[model samples]
Target chain A: MTAALAARDLVVGYRRGRRARTVVLDGVSLTLAPGQFACLIGPNGSGKSTLLRTCSGLQPPLHGELLLAGKDLRRLTRLDVARRVAAVLTDRHDTGRLTGRDLVGLGRYPYTGWFGRLEGDDDRVVAGALEAVAATHLAHRVVAELSDGERQRVMIARALAQQPSLLILDEPAAFLDVTARVELVALLRELTREHGLAVVLATHDLELALRSADTVWVLDAEHRLATGLPEDIAAGGALGRAFPTGSWAFDPVEWRFVFCGTVRGVATVAGDSLHATLARRILEREGFVVNPPDVGPGVQLAIEVLEPPHAAPTVIARHAGGVETHRALQPLADLARRVAADARPGETPR
Target chain B: MLTEERVAAHPEPAPRASVDGQAPARGRAALVFPLLGLLLVVVFVLGIAVGSVPIPVVDVVKVLTGHEPHGVYHAIVFDIRLPRSITGVLVGAALGVAGLQLQTLFRNPLADPFVLGVSAGASLGVALVVLAGASSEATFLAGLGGLGDVGIAGAGTLGAAAVMVAVLFAARRVRSTITILVVGLMVSYLVASLVTVLIASADGPRIQQFLAWEAGSFRAITWSQLHVLVPVLLVGLLAAAAGVKQLNALLLGERYAATMGVDVRRTRFVTIGTAALLAGVATAFCGPIGFLGIAIPHLARAALGSSDHRLLVPASMLLGGTVALAADIIAQLPGADFVLPLNAVTALLGAPIVIWVVLSSRNAGTLGA
Candidate 1:
């Protein structure tokens, strides 16, 4: 089967003045199948948005060819393209006091007659679109009165009403809260699988993209487009290569990237104690999931937790003073502290 | 039925489908409204013909059927009442269609030709002609003189053109619909102030004529003027008819319109220019008749149960013309000899309908506080 959308060696740009122009994408190529949900991810100014716009035919490519359903984009009329591709842009415009149902029904304009009289099928399409996006209850509510998440869902519903084979969204999750974003991603996943819609969305939420998308299109600083499986891109350190200077690094173990400095406080505790357990738990909750052991002079954890919600047991000692605390192992110290604490405790602590 | 089953992925199609097919069965559905409008036209014509002089309905029919009637009867039907009634129809349809287009284009129920400053432009144009020495008598004679000299009507068209240009420019520069409306109001205010200054500075006779013209009258329109107006109004109505599809596309935003294969920029150009031409020409000749444009579309929508302009435009034109003719008959009815400014008569009907629309909006009612 032919790809629903394909762009070959495309360059995209916008005119700044009568003559001057700024180019955002250069020689990029990509293809999306009917049932694939693809995500375009990059740092700001990396031109992911520009590429998506070009592919959707909202913005013309400065060079190269775009094909939709086996027809060249340039050869297709505006109305013909509209019947095939749909989009949900980032900017929200208030169309006065229109109902959500009215807004969605507008998506059927291309198919409706000159008078825009709603035939039976038009109403059915609009209703199904509303149901698909879970915005049926909001059908009668004025569009301007909807919440951001609700409004976003309404926009999706409107796009669905077009009954286009391909749907492109620009940051559909941008205004949504965490839970809404997750639900929206899951919704996109389900929509692709059920309807076989070729979906392309641009978002900064990398975790969601990694979790949901069938393919990831990464835009490098040089404007090169790279398309592959999410895991392959993560493994290649393309994110670090794309964004070089930040505190960004690929965490091979977790299969993701983190963008923060490495934490630096060390503690040593007695073997078989609770403080070591409590310290590890606190650090993990704080996004510091890595714990590496050292051969020379680091702390060793030996701890246990009691009943529910109670602090665990641990041992800690200072090397110079040979100080050791028992019954309540507060903080952990280095290897030298364990030797000194062993002398202080005199209990042959492991 | 097979096609129906194939398209059944859509929910809730059955009710709408039945509604679409059963329009004829519904009480006072689309056909009834148009037929009623035709009946009103007939009644209005007879109302205009039968007067204090009490011309027989048969004489009125004979006079309208273009046969030679008795001396005074012919003079009354053709010379006096016919011109007035036709003028009412022309102005009413023009204002009504213009109003509907404006309201739909702005997506605001309150939008009308007068509120959008088109009428102000016409008023300014008329004020310039009268205060500038082409008085109403001069205007009437100019009509008699083969429309050679520039007068109130011509000035009105020029004024409307200026307003249309300003509003269109603002629409291009400012993307927000509300901002465009505020700009239109501001432009109208400035033009009104200029008209006021002209009135204050005018000499006595010119001031009296200007004031009278502002009151708005249909009696001044002669048969010769109707010849010019009928063709212009027809052309404008035809132009608006071509734009029904474009207007439907515009019910959504320009972006969506463009996405749906509508040439947004081109639609805006054609829709605004043609609507402005219709409104401006009608206002110029008819002395800025009020309310028909704003209210007639609503009445048509109520009658037809649809907002699609293909039906709404023709419905509005016919309905508005009928209402205007009826209103003219009522304006002439109170006394045998006396007459009223057509604007006052129209406002009595137009204002309440507008208020009803604003009040009917559940949101606007709450926001009114």
Candidate 2:
């Protein structure tokens, strides 16, 4: 099947004047197939938004060809592009006294008559779009009265009402809280599968993108676009390098960036997966250099997490001085403090 | 996740309706438009009846329907009051709708043709003609009855269109609404100073005529003048009606409107053009009437509780006509011998309403929202 959207050797930029130009991203190529959920992740000013705008045909590409379902973007009228690709930008418009349904109805602009009168079929489509986003109840409520998350959902419904083949959003989850962000991304993922839409969203949400997206487009500082499966990108270290972790390292296993601190002392953690990872996190936070089980010579300290089914796990810590065991994790903090004191004599452990 | 499944399973109980009962509020809001229409009819008749002559309502109706009432009463009702009242309604409706369009286009609550210097431009055009010895030609044209009104209306329309074009040019350069607003205010001051200079250089009788015109009244619109005013106002209104969808789309901001397939530049041009014509024609006939354009849209929104242009455009027309008639009635003062300046009466009525709307919308925190 042909891709829903394709950019070939695209160079996006703005012309400054008669002769001068500012290039944002150059020599970029990507394709989005139907039913695929792709996320564009990059740091600030890395041209992610510019690329999304270019792909949506909101701005003309300075160089190269953009195709929408194998049709040249340049040949298509704005209405033609609008019919096939819907976009939700980050601009917050104050639609005074407009109901949610009215806003969502605007998505049908290209399909409606000259005066934009909504037929019965158009109303049904708008309702369906609202239903898809679980915002049917908000249909009659004033759009300005809605919360940020609710408004975002309404905007998504508006995009969906267009019934486009591809949907592009720029920082849709920027203003949402953690749970709202997760729910929004999950909702987009579900819509992509159910509606067979090629959904591309530019987001600062790395963790959500890594966890939920089918494919990830990582734009690095050098203007290189790397496309791969989310897991492949994470495993290949492209995602990490694209984001550039300064004080932290991407933990592929945890699917998050973990803080990397200076090594205070060496220790070995031995336990099941859950408890071992938790212990490692706690020790690492305290500046202890934790090693994988049986991987390194951790001469000073050894910690064992004992997990018995249906009971609280017990932590046992061994040091040069003695062995300390506790039923609760709070005791592990105390043990870490003691170890720190022992490691550096006459130094207070805070 | 499970939340999605739960929502799908229990679709009957939509969650938002529980917080706010949307249906009843919407139903109550629906009654406001008809109520405003009824109020307009009452004010329209009152405007025709309660003029300087104090014709009884029955006699006013008789003369309006071509009954041979007393000859003097017939002349007052048919010749004097009817034309003035009609002019009031048309001018009111024109300014009201123009104000609404200006507000939406600029996304500024304080936007209006008068405030944006379009009306001032119209005044400057009339001043140029009346004070610059073109008065003899204008008077000669006035002798030709309706033809004179058309010439003045033409001049006013051209002037207003010129200012609108300048504003549109400035709008392209300035991204901030507040900056554009300040620019419009500067334009108004510039035009006002020029008009002042023209007045200072004019003779006494010309200054008196200009002052009366500046004072603003519907009395100037003779029956013959309506021929020019009505068609111009209607064309402007039709243009505005045709662009209702674009106007509503524009409420979402220009980029989103474009994404919705609206040609932003063309819509802007058409909208500003329509507003200028309406305001300029009204100014030409009524001598730069103020307050109705700025105040009436807010009143309409406050009544209907929606910015949906489909309803707002008509609601504004009715409410604007009503307010203008009411202002004219107060200016005439019916039974009293002395008539207040139409401009002063409108300012008195409009300034309070505008201040009230500003304070209330501000308190409600819906100004920008």
lDDT of 2 at B31: 83
Q: How do the residues B22-98 of candidate 2 rate in per-residue lDDT, one tens digit apiece? A: 45445655787678878887887788888655767776667777786665688777788788888888889999999
lDDT of 1 by residue, A1-350 (tens): 88889888877999665878888887778889888999988888888777777777777777898998778999988777887788887775544445677678778877888666668678777777777787877776767678888988888888877777788898878778998888888888877887777898899887778768999888778776778898887777676666666444656456555534433223332233344555444433222322445423443232232332465343433434455544442343233334333432222111
Give the interface RMSD of candidate 2.
5.5
DockQ of each: 0.20, 0.26
Model 1 Cα RMSD, Å?
A: 7.6
Which pairs clash in model 2?
none
What would the per-residue lDDT of candidate 2 be over residues A129-203, giving only the tens digit for each residue? Answer: 888898988888888888889999999989887777889999988788998888888889988887778899899
The true-versus-predicted C-alpha distance at residue A146 of model 2, in Å, is: 2.4
Chain B TM-score, all predictions listed: 0.84, 0.84
Per-residue error for B243 in candidate 2, Å, reads 0.8
- Best candidate per TM-score, number? 2
> Model 1 Cα displacement at A293 (Å)?
3.1
